[model samples]
Target chain A: MSDMSRPGVIHDLGYRHYDGLREGTPAIARTLFVTGLRHVYGLGRSGKSKVMPFLLLAMSVLPALIVVGVVVLTGLDSLPVSYADYTNQTQLLVSLFAAAQAPVLFSRDLRHRSIVLYLARPLSAPVFAVMRWLSLTVALWLFMAVPTLMLFIGAMLSGLDKSDQVTQLLKAVVLQTLLALLIAGITGLISSVSLRRGFAVVGSVMALIVLTGVVTAVQAIAAEQDADSASTTAGLFSPWSLYSGLANAWDAGIDTFVPVDGAWAVAYALVALLLAAACLLALVARFRKVGSR
Target chain B: MAVVTGERTGQAPVITTAGLTKHYGSVHALTDLTVDVGEGVTGLVGANGAGKSTLIKILLGLLEPTGGHARVLGHDIEHESQEIRRLVGYMPEHDCLPPDVSASDFVVHMARMSGLGASAARERSADVLRHVGLDEERYRPMGGYSTGMKQRAKLAQALAHDPRLVFLDEPTNGLDPAARNDMLRLVERIGSDFGIAVLVTSHLLGELEQVSDHVIVLDGGHLLRSSATGDFLQRTGSLLVEVVGTETERDRLGEALAQRGLVCRPRGAMVAIDPPPSELAQEGAAHDLIRDVAAELGLGLMRLQPDRGHLEDVFLDGAPRV
Candidate 1:
């Protein structure tokens, strides 16, 4: 089908100036947010980077899938585990995901000195810090949302009450978002500060996993010793305990070692919000200082 | 051969700084200095710790000057760094690429960071990569690239945004001889063919002689000289004579030339004569005298050549004397 007689000519169009619409900070932030989200899940990166995130993801989802299977085959009236309780049960896997993936978004650029490339007119240090935080928060929320969705679908398939399942699933979604925001702040702050992958991962694991474990153990001991206020106060020390305390207070079918009450519950919410805000402010300051020579 | 550089479309000097000073504790990284960089390829030449990198970072607005005023493309550096960032791109002196990403991905990301949309970022990344001669190798991860390829990738990202000006910080560092030549040629094309103004830095003064239209010499955080490249390579107005013998013959020739009237001295294996005396100022008078002196001494004269100045001469005795 080719014209054999005609000679092929390659035209050299010289370098042309760009005259198109150049977006501003919003567009730059959007692009960074999308890229950061994809990179955390190892979507746009090297093949080897996909292993740890996907492995952690699979491990987190497996228990929900098994729960769904059991409810479907036995034709139970309702699922054995509540949706809000699912994330708390998978806390170890969730903590590992945050620890393993935060470095991909935060530490690698600073460690490799590639963060300088992102400092342009539209993408300043503050905007970069906030967009990266948003990406990690959204990624974490999605990590919890998937299993909850599966449970909702499984419950619906087995003829559970639609309104009741929706209410509990909605509560779980809200709690997951709150939990994600706090954890993202902690991990992003740790990774940005460490600037070394191994140290960043270990620091995040200590903050999100080890610190939370200690808080939970202390809260359980306080509750066993008939100290209600101390147990409730200990739950405010970690992101995971705060999520569970709020869940139990809201009647989301989560049973905490000590029940969170009126003023203490308000303190828990305020601490979570203020701590996340403090982390973000610290990130902005860190980025601004690091951007200079 | 000199490259045919394009006009700068009638703009101010690409960069200007006045009384710029930077100090850390007691160490002065950049002292009270002032300079202006015009269009085309203006080479910032200095030795190590000569403040070349310090100057570039300050111009990019990434470092604050303790006291000074600077402007890039008419944008104030202190208050209007955002505007300067929009108009200029900087290829840093150190490694700025991650090992896991390919050149294509990284350039596209940088272009997007510069506010280009997705499709525009991709298109410009491809064009700039091909322009830097990384056509087929751009798809591989930069970790596997040679030093030359890494330099090219760095340049590609700087060019992807279509800025009016770019600052290249030691673009030929860590490159082999041939690769250095290639990189120089690419820097020239960015200025001449693409009509982009470039401010490139190098510690090697000789390398910029072939590509730079204007040269600025920095010595110990001070401005030694700033002028056109031709001025630094002018003829020294001295003639050198060599004989086909040992140092003894060269010394004898030098002594004989000096004994006669010409003020001559020994320069390595040659006898260097300052411009001949007024009485013997005829064009070839020095040549004839050197020839007769060598023949009479039973030494074969090998070469009689005029001495030319080099950019390196600026450092040897300081350009201030020159």
Candidate 2:
């Protein structure tokens, strides 16, 4: 072959050999988790993706801002809203955030058929599923916690009694974190199975929000008929009811959407944990099939 | 880069499979297949449903085989699949890119997943993207890229980790002829210049004939033939002769050559002359006879070339049984 007619030039683009340690499974999982987190918040995505998550987060915090404003202007010795009640009040925004963002973490990959790329890496199917769930859980926690944190800060700056309020607020934030995990788990599971983003969003909202209303209504009807056991058992069908039941049972002062008494509160806590675990198991099982369309 | 020479030493095969099989319920995607692939560019030629993707996924440890076993780069496909994946790069057969992520970011993330450090991953991503002939467009989101550009971006990510081997499944799919040629040349360079073993697949049999050192033909999930590219393209015992004139000259040569005791037939504007039997043949005897006959008949001999076999011949010849 003659080379004179075809002029060629080589430019070094600094393609270097990687002699550093090739981290193992944990590192791969961590990278996916971080990537999933960024994806949920639309950090690397287009401008349209940034809309839903930011809007939901702002909606979640807006009421807390108003409460703080009212307290600061009126100089109330005690905060008007209780810490635990704050999450319950903004539960709708938190649920909406989960419905919108869970699909971003789970459904987009399957819809684009990009899950194959992730599975071909060193990470296993279970690890990938767990990491995505964890990322969404953390994001949901931040969405709920930010508003609660704002209220806590407002109370502290307004010279309210720091000791009791801080203790109660910390408990409430922990409860909110648990609730976020429960919501993320359920929505993540739904998103994984529903390959279409629109379907996943609708399904998640229905599972997390609409079902709560239906279950609460059923519980109220059951209580009106004096069927106490059926009323308490009906609350188990809705995660919001279960969370409220547990929080209210722990402290009688905390107002809950659904009143849970006696050992049913313990059952509610156990069922919530079990539901999260079940969702995780379903996600792992879905990914383990090896070929996901 | 040092090639990781596993248990095998001299002339070791890069991939070896024995009785590998896969089935999806009643549909048997791959039957019992056994083959050994050596270093360099090996083309896997098959129809769309010939289980090419199934075999690649099995080798990468992404899909479990229904029966038999295989190994890539001396690692067991079943047990050491993670090891196989860590060392082998894969460009899937389908569109698997995230539309929202830029090529640079996606490739870097893939490199990191392959265990490259942050700086190394970024540098490797840039280098591979450039090597694949991607320029400033690499920074743009992949959704807007043309099919050729998307294929190149996929190739760039597959090479970002600089593995010892790579499985490129239909890298030239959906590309125009010019772009296909460019992609084939890049594939050839990856094997030759980078010293990385490549197992590339394609449905177009003619496309791999140029770039592949070895070719494997699969039919209905069964191994039809596996051999060196030269073996598949060995010269048949025939010669094609083209004359200066059109059909008239070609028929004249065919008749004249037939009279000389050579089996001759007109193929388009050319006459295909079967080689003379060994008992009546000598070196250049056929050539001399053709020239003499053409000269006597006042016909100009334009071309006298041996009829070469093609990769498609394997499928065409085996089509009856299949």
Candidate 3:
């Protein structure tokens, strides 16, 4: 050890003030971005993601293969719906991908209290909210996009193209991607607010599947009661109805079958985006209050 | 700024809070707590659910208080928490480490997040790991480590950033006696050698008596006492004099003191004297009387000091014993 009495040693001279860089906006954002990457990668020394990407692909393709096998064996193509039409439905893609993957997106952090470590750092709650939502949205997007693309390509390679198949496939893929983003954003937001992963997952799924279905059923009953103004009655809440109206307006009537947009889809997207933003704001508020302690 | 620069003789307290109260629904975690923790090792002693973790969490900017305000290193906890977090390091009470990552990599990442450059972060992580006595085990994933090793790893990460102030909650919570002693020595070194301001908490008050310069005792959620360790250990105006002899010699000395009308009690080879204040006014008469009594009994005086209770007495009746 060096001399204790000098009081002028190179490093041990005295208590040095840490004249370091101030933690500003960029610093906070960089911390959040790194945390987002860590969330994607999971907590492992070997740099392997705890939640595997291939598992989601497997889940998606397993159902698709079963559907194709049933269609080929039973000669169900004689019905009005062809194999291509059945394969290119947004609802099937959404339910399959979302049913397995959406829970893990934001639920893990809340359950583990890993979010506390992030809030203790430079990242504020709002930044954490946006980053987590974006990370999950991207994760779910990749999980859904690749399998759907494979299905489309495989359908084209097969001998079942009726000229409008290409347009239909493109519409199906685009709409499914948008749907995944919207659903993942809303689910991730809802999941972040809760501490129990199971509760968060169940609550989010109920909000999306049960609540929306109830609203549509109520609107349909109202429309039947007022048959004189069926158009006005259907104006309330129907994502499928809204999309069908929009598709009918377009060259093809993809929306005629899909019915995910009109006034309802706009309202759904807007309300989802607003709820997502509100969740983000609540997260910020939570962090600010915690950090102020 | 004005308060920080004022002319004060003692080292500045890194954390000061007044009337700091925090309630969760009907349960109060901290109630009307006003404490000033100075530089060096200050131990916050209390049992579980006695507000030790709550206090540390509040200091680290992880929980908001229901009432009152506090400052850490002259920064308002409400407005300048990000700044305070940068300056102060915190070691939490629980096992929050990611079990799959090696201590070295995780600590380095934590350091870099605190604004250290890549090379500096790596170097500091290595140094702190060593300082906390982690050898080759530092490279192993925390999942396989024992509880003692995990606590060391946690402490290493808290110090990786070279923070000037550190809040260590139950640093020796689950350690063996030997390991607890080692951890306490390391904590003492952090305050005395590295010159880092330390606020350590423990459920056992005796564990902190030798390490802490000042002690703040909390009970149920209220501040029971906040003072220097010596204040709690002050003499009750009674002297415990030990003589080198048999119990008869001690009894004889006690009998002689009682003959002189000085209240004396026999305690093994010692006699505890309760000298009257009027004797103190006789200008060194109390010292002379004790010397004469020991000489007359032909017994060697081994020790003489004003009687003071042990640190454990503070928690005996659940109030300030002093």
Candidate 4:
């Protein structure tokens, strides 16, 4: 009976066939989607351990918002006010939004070596790259979108309206969301290439805030030195500077100090898009190399 | 490609790899490894960083080799890894249990991922888990499990998919001795009872002597030796002799044997001697020499026997002394 019991158990598992490759496109796509969803829910349902930088972001912006609010609330009529001025302050919020969301979205998988588990099943590197980038871009857009909308509401209600008020407000929110996604995607791609999460985050923040700022300052000086030439907006190739150009466009004119328009803005978006794609492809290539090793 | 439904028809090995090499930058994890593992239980013995894990990973298609190729169950591992993964069961070297998932749920999910239907997956998972000795505790989160239970859970997951080839990578790594024995026995049954091809790896070489049909020794990511278990334990032609009467009698017998020009060494109460090959030609003379030597010194012969090499000796010789 003991012998009988033994074979009975082995027989029950039946048989498995794994000699042939599974090449069905539908099956591959389904597996990729399911795995991507698993990653999304895995991070989201990781409970309260999900690092919420919203609080830290609010604290950082609170001081600047208070300064703006004090002047507005006290009816300080002599204080400077315009849509362009509001856009500049909101630019700080955009930078803060980029700083908060990019690291958590990109670096968490690499930090945990969870990429090994994810890639081992069925998904390859390119599918993984596209899925993860889309997940992060969508999550970042949501995180940055709702708050920016609320701020837009607050701005509109703050007794500021012109003939192009509605169009400008809608355009501002749409451009801000697109710009946030572009920045998040670029940073996410960059961060995935780095080994440590903290270093990646620090590097991305510096790239967005410092390097891009320096480039835009250099361009501004160049445009001033050669006033005859079209405004030197070449620095807009950086996503942060590209968004700055978007704000300039929203103002219906350049800051004069930093002229931008015509083919220059298109060239900026083209370069940023190309860099974002190239970084994404590099991320895919990196994963293949790491996993193959 | 058509699925070959029954057992393998040819005498070809289930796994064969040639010139398998893996390098982690400058560190050669596996170097110039060539092995052909037949059906049944084969034990891979090595110390840490001895390339046991690297070979297993290469076989499982989780790693791509730098120099060579491995075929599992007649499938090319480099080009057809997904298929290899489907046919082979792999228990990883590390503790990688998802904390929130129960053992049963995780194993069932794995079975399904290997292409089982819902009912088959559930039924197989339960049966495999039960066979592994996990009880109601299996329903609990694996995060709180003891090392033995966790090891069993990992083993169960590997078997749940009904794989033809299973790579048990240090399955008994953290288990207590009893648990280790149980896991080893389970591994033995997987080969003998189920007709599965099992390649189990361990740093502890001697423990696999009884269960393994073949033993493969790996050192510094290279194959040192591979042989049948019996071949590993064959006699080495030396014999141990022990005579009991009095301590003086035993020593005098030893002295007399040495005076006779026999090469003998005092080993505890027993004096071991290497029999002259000419004396070995006649069994009676060899026996008489031992008895005569003891009697000449008025010692009573208690025991005299040929020394058979043990699996430990094989490992000792093959293992890197450093």
Candidate 5:
């Protein structure tokens, strides 16, 4: 006897062909920047990954909140805390944030050897490096700017004089942006070279914190010994001192952590620009050779 | 089937390298190697450190060659790498997936990087993941996946963009025998059914013989051999004849074939006959003689075929010891 014939079926899972517009390098860089920004704050990662960044962010905003509270309660016309000096006061927290988070943006890809996947796309190494640097720079800017924005909002709510306060706050925000770029460039460079997370975190923290401490000590001893040039040069070694020197040079009214004045101001500005450019160049070079081996 | 052979009548070469050399300081990773890869599944067979990965990287434009020039899909490797990368996909040999990301998210991100729009990336990622047989498990973190699942995830990402060409670097690296066979079948389907050119690498010589339309062997950073898979296993001028029943039946056939002035020997349940002398080179002479001998002996001829070469023979003969 013949067997019974069965009906056949075909499934349509909507696997459509994509004939849409394909973006080029700029769109790719933008996508990478957005993804990296989310990664920096642990947005797509596990819950455990969110703790450190949130904690550090809260810590950064605490002092600003307290200042704003005092201004609101006492009904002061002017903020007790100068906006420009807030970054200096909270430099440790900003440095810590950069140290802890730069690896999340830069090192993890290399450690997991995922850089190959990235480079295999229609992206170049230099573009990848620049996008990563820009993402961290923007993240750091937001990290510092949010608290400063809070202070501005508090002053406005308390009915402080509009023109002068806004002017000063705007200048402080500019200075903070510069400081953010400086920190991101240096920390991102260090993290790019150290693929191990623990090692990269330690290296970034030490480079930003320990080196600044040593430079500060040397500046202090040099100033006491009446060594003017030595103290000025000492201030050039650490990102914190460099930002402080630039602020002083720009006449921001914030107290300089180290004595940077006269011709030293131009020197400090030149050195900071050169240092940022150098770190960026190094990062590009590192990524260029990333998967070649 | 109209297979797309890169060097065949109408198809052009998919990849071409001329005098390609790479040096890592004192270590020469790839010597002056020149080769052409046609369409279809082309297997790249070599031992470990035989420059298989190096060649793939160079072809993908991920690594710069110290010497020589190359092109992929008509794009120059040196000047037009962006164009090359835009058209090709790569599945690296190492463990490259992030531990925290799900396979779906990662594949979608890869598709986006390949210039797909947001909606297209998501849709393509789903399609490729399903094609690679990663079901609901694709939504879980890749760090928790087994080795075979990870390989499938890598393959899905490589296909996420619907590339015209793909360089799969050891897709079956850690797979068991069954998984390995499945991966090979998928590779063959990619080349034949999907019409995408594939350059897959493996150290296991025999495994690729079944799937690859063409095989290229490399040894010590040099091109050892390149040819069609059938050419690599072409007939070796001998015939294998099997008869039904036990050794007695096979022996009777062998003895009768010998008595017919044809040299033959028992091989398991079959008899092997070497090529006859030049005087017996006339068409159908050897065939008719064997048929007549078997008929005279009343033997049941079960099978008759030419002895074919194997990939292992090529590897054993040409591959240098590591």
Candidate 6:
């Protein structure tokens, strides 16, 4: 639209030598990470790719918005949903978001042979792998953070007890971040191995949703039988249960049939970090193999 | 240094490999490949499984060779590969474009990966895509692009970083005849006009003969031949005389040349005459003999030139590898 933007202006500027600052490895990693994050939400991709992420996001925030509206209108003494419990209730949406988007970041490049383009640069395979994992981790965190932020804003506007809401919101933010990291790890590992998009999505769903359902059933049965140890131990198998187990341990207001305490509480946090680390290592190895090919 | 060919590339050595070897378990992908490749357009000629991609990967630090060492633009490929890759652009032989992103966006992203600042990346990406002949088509998603357009997009990304050298692996693989020529011309310009040293690979020896200043032939993980393209196509010291007449007239010319003590043989529609002995190598003696014989035989001469060899002759003559 400026003076140089006239329609008749020539665009064929031929090749010019770039003697500018060619940044180091950190710049490359940062660019890759940014591109990856944009691709996850379909920001720079096709319009069709934008549909699923936004639809799921809208579905996630709609309930929170409705809750805010009801609390403001009815003048309730306290909002029915706890700040930490909102993410728990919308677990399906969060899992669906992660399941649907992880392959877009991790699988497509490998499947389409585009990883060759990235690795051909000054970046190594390990750096590329870590950058991709970090992108998905941050994206998954943002997906949860947006809605949590909405709830916090709504609670503040509704004149709720400032200290309590802020404290519970801080707890929710902590739990969501840890949960995003763990889910990103599991989904990224699965998406990378199962290069096919459908297979990756199914594999991630099976891990995040179906496995958690199974663990929940086992925990319910164990708690009913008065075996607190067995119920607590059942949470170690999947990322969702690990999140809930950690939430229970931290008293983040999400109810669990069995208390995650003592050595088990420490074990939950340790397992989450360990699992994420393991997945990252595996991703780096997988990428190294792909790059070698 | 011992592996020097007949003609130098006239530019500084951009890539040099010494005793370079690579093996995948028992399969040798590259074996003891020692060569000094200088600045210019050098063609890496080989068949499908002849280790072209393997060597590029090792040189780019993407794969580790089993033994030996190499250097690219003065950086040791084994120890200083990051620096090598930083200066060298690579266009892989595979499909590397993601379907959902436009070519402009993809190229800008690749430029950034090469460490260009954001604005510079954008400016460079636009110029490169234009240079590669991608117009408004670059703005559209690459999913529906033709093979030629996709190839151009791939090429544009490689040039986006303005590398000092580029390793282009089979740039004309999927193109039709016209597109192949266009890509070759683009490659030529990239080497000459842009002043970037080029290492382009092609299985078609003849095509590379047209664009490459030097050609290195690899067969079954062995260095078959590495020389200037002109050397491969040099005259074999034999005169090919094409006659405008029937086969009988051509045979008559051959017989006359043979009677004159000149070793001559009929080759299709022409007679191939070996260089005369020094006794008969008098100035204009062989040419006068050829002219007089053709005149007396009532056969018109269509063409007269030295019999230049082809790159394919290297394989046919040696043919030791499968």
Error of 5 at B106 (Å): 0.4
Better of 1 and 2 by DockQ: 1
DockQ comparisons of all candidates to the true complex: 0.65, 0.56, 0.20, 0.11, 0.65, 0.81
Q: Clashing residue pairs in candidate 2, if any?
A: none
| Residues forming the 10-long window of minimal summed lDDT in candidate 5 chain B | B1-10
lDDT of 3 by residue, A140-230 (tens): 5555566555554455444345465577656655554554456666566566566465677577667555655665566567555654235
Give stretches of model 1 more than 4 Å off: A1-16, A69-79, A158-163, B1-11, B242-252, B276-306, B317-322
Maximum-TM-score candidate = 6
Q: Which residue pairs clash in candidate 5?
A: B6-B38, B6-B39
Deviation from truth (RMSD, Å), model 2: 4.2
Pick the winner on TM-score between candidates 2 and 4: 2
Residues A124-220, model 5: lDDT tens digits: 8899999999999999999988998999989998889989788878888888887778889999988989888888889988999999989989988
Candidate 1 or 5, higher TM-score? 5
lDDT, candidates in the order shown: 0.87, 0.85, 0.67, 0.67, 0.86, 0.89
Q: Which pairs clash inside model 4? A: none
Expressed between 0 and 1, the share of native interface contacts present in candidate 5 is 0.77
Q: Residue-wise lDDT of candidate 4 within A185-281, one digit each (tens)? A: 6677667776475777677777777777776677677777885233455565467666657556556322545655677667765765676677677
Q: Which candidate has the top score in DockQ?
A: 6
Give the candidate order by descending lDDT.
6, 1, 5, 2, 4, 3
Candidate 1 lDDT tens digits, A1-293 = 35556679545677888889888777778888999999999998888989998898888888989989999999999889999999999999999999999988889888888888777444778888999999999999999998889999999988899999999999999999999999999999999999888999999999988999899999989999999899999998899999999899888878999777788778988998999999999999998888875
Best candidate, lDDT-wise?
A: 6
- How far residue B308's Cα lies from its native spot in candidate 6, in Å, is 1.4
CAPRI docking class of candidate 2: medium
Docking class of 1: medium
Give one digit per residue, the lDDT tens place, for model 1 in B1-322: 1121223336578888888888877877777778777888899899888888888878777788888889889888998887788878889888988987899999998998898989999999998998888987798889998889999999999999899999999999999999999999998888899988899999998789989888888888877777778888777878999999899988888888888898988888888899888888888887888889888889998999988888888787675321
lDDT: worst 10-residue window of model 6 chain A: A6-15
